[model samples]
Target: MAYTLHNLPAKLEASKMATLGYARVSTQDQHLTGQLEALKAAGAETIYREKISGARADRPQLAKLMAALQPGDTVIVTKLDRLGRSTRELLDLIQRIGDARASFRSLGDPLWDTSSSQGRLLSTLLAAIAEFERDLIRERTGDGRKRAMADGIKFGRKPKLSDFQRAEAIKRRAAGETLGAIAKSYAVDISTISRLRA
Candidate 1:
């Protein structure tokens, strides 16, 4: 079903429910000025700013904003990526917000507002599509791996120790040699010798 901002119900009251905004730039070279201005114009009372990699989920400013949210509050982001790096992460954050009896919206994507019933439905549909996409990618990856294996293409890291070295290490261990001594003789870490047992 199609949903638009205009057709949607009246926006939540900012007085009763705070409309907080989040602005993030993936690198220190980027600036948050534009996002801040847009968010302020969109009626965001308070804003959280962060300059960090989006791939990192442990954003300090985002953590503080999430913790500060209360029931009836709405979180606003200049873009969806400002909230999360990927669709799965976005959905996870939205789920947490919903659980807190709060809502989320992105100025970049008007269709993604959790403040209304239609928006909530859209959110569910988007999340399902994201999950389906991930599953398809995983299936294709597995198929590719199987095909490569059939073609005699090896996968995974090359063995750190040769077969002869491995066999010698086993013999040394059986001969009551210390693990550190075996590792030193082979010029490899102790973990490498331990893995030979498997």
Candidate 2:
């Protein structure tokens, strides 16, 4: 569907003056004041604030607000990213709002809301672009890693003991030294000594 906020139901009719605002901050130290201020500027009322990671799909307050929203209510957020940074999540939420016959608007990103036809279309396109960007990043990373591995680029920490040290361990073991003694002498794990010997 050509997503546009105008095509979506305006939960609050033009007659309704109040807009419900939702603000989220992923960290406790981060304040929601800025978001609230922006929402208020956008003519929102009764702003609900939560300090929780948008990465978390289940947010109690946000869910409750969505559920409690009436047809005449418009949900306002400070930014599209505030609602959700993930494309899948944003799209799913907008779809849910449609089912609930509610409206949505964002103050930050232009591709923010689904309360207007243009906004909805922009939102959908933005979400798809985000998803595409993520996929491309993953693909590039995988290819780069593969190329690196092929170039004999080693990863992780180097072994504590050198070849000479390892050879000495084998000689000591052959000379009847216990694995524990050998491990303790070399300051290495018992499993490491055992594996080296094996």
Candidate 3:
């Protein structure tokens, strides 16, 4: 390669162009293929697909798509729910896209695009409502957990060992044996054995 400013014209980097498509499904039986087909019909240059719970936040594929977005580009999804299980997260993602100088379009909902005045207004209003709902859920969940704790209702998974099993485990531990060996015999964790001894 030779730097020739005399005869050859100076080359400039091309402007960024991007249109990403996102598809999601709630179950194994719910095929994402239909969403993909619809996205393609909507003229998406790239596609991202995933199978996860709507309530899950750690979607690696969605993160990748967001990272790859460019200014003047768009993020297209079959629907708003496909973008997120949480209302606030969905609103945050759309806001981020706007901050990135990009846009969002939904195949199902006509209010996503900011082209029309009504569409733009609806987008902002809906995003606000979603954010409010998410906050309310968080507050309610915290309050409910606190109430349950006061009422002596334990949250999360229950202990697998009964009081009788715990007594037997204590006896086994007192008889001289490795916790691992005891656990192997009973098919339980060493921590479980330690708790029993305690």
Candidate 4:
């Protein structure tokens, strides 16, 4: 059954409810000025800002912000990606907020708000799209690797020592030459020379 705003939980008053904003940047070099301003304009009473990669699971400020949420409070972000780097994480966060009786909103994606029935529907649709995108990327990458393998193309770093160089090194070592001498002569690391024996 489709959820309606009227059938669900009572609508909380905007004045009585607190809107907590979260702003994130991928690197320390990036600035959070624009997001901060937007959050402030959106009436965020308390803002949590971070300059850490979204791919990283450890976000101290985000943790603290979520912990501080109370029933009827709303969590707001400038964009969906600011909340999570992956679709799974995004869905998990939304679920967590909902379980806490708090709402979630994204200023960039207006439909992402969980304050109404329509917004909730849009969030589900968006999550499906994100999953579809990730699947497409994985398929394309696998196909590309298979194609490259068929073309006799190498994937990783080139060997530092050629096969012929390795044979010569082994022969020289058998003749009582030191591993360091062989490594120095071949312009490679001692570990490279040692690895040839194994």
- The ten-residue window of minimal lDDT in model 1 covers 1-10
lDDT: worst 10-residue window of model 4: 1-10
CA-lDDT, candidates in order: 0.84, 0.77, 0.78, 0.85
Name the best candidate (by TM-score): 1
Query: Across residues 4-44, which tens digit of lDDT does each residue of candidate 2 receive?
Result: 12232366444564477888899999987787778777876
lDDT of 4 by residue, 1-198 (tens): 111112223454333677889999999899998988898888886788889999898999899888878899999999999998877899989989988899999999988889999988877887788789889999999999999999999899999998899899999988989999999998999999988862
TM-score, one value per model? 0.70, 0.56, 0.58, 0.62
Q: Candidate 2, overall lDDT?
A: 0.77
Candidate 1 residue 178 C-alpha distance from true site, Å: 7.7
Against the true structure, candidate 1 has what lDDT?
0.84
| Residue clash pairs of candidate 4 | none
* Candidate 1: tens digits of C-alpha lDDT, residues 1-198: 111122223454423677778888889899888998898888777788888898885898888888878899889988888898887888999999999999999999998889888889988998899989989999999999999999999999998899898999999999999999999987999999987873
TM-score of 3: 0.58
RMSD of each: 7.7, 8.4, 8.7, 8.7
Residue-wise C-alpha lDDT for candidate 3, range 1-198, written one tens digit per residue = 111112322242125456778888877778887888898888776688887777777877788888877788888898989996766678788888888888888889987785467766887898878778879999999999999999999988987787887787788889888889878877888887887754
Model with the higher TM-score, candidate 2 or 3: 3
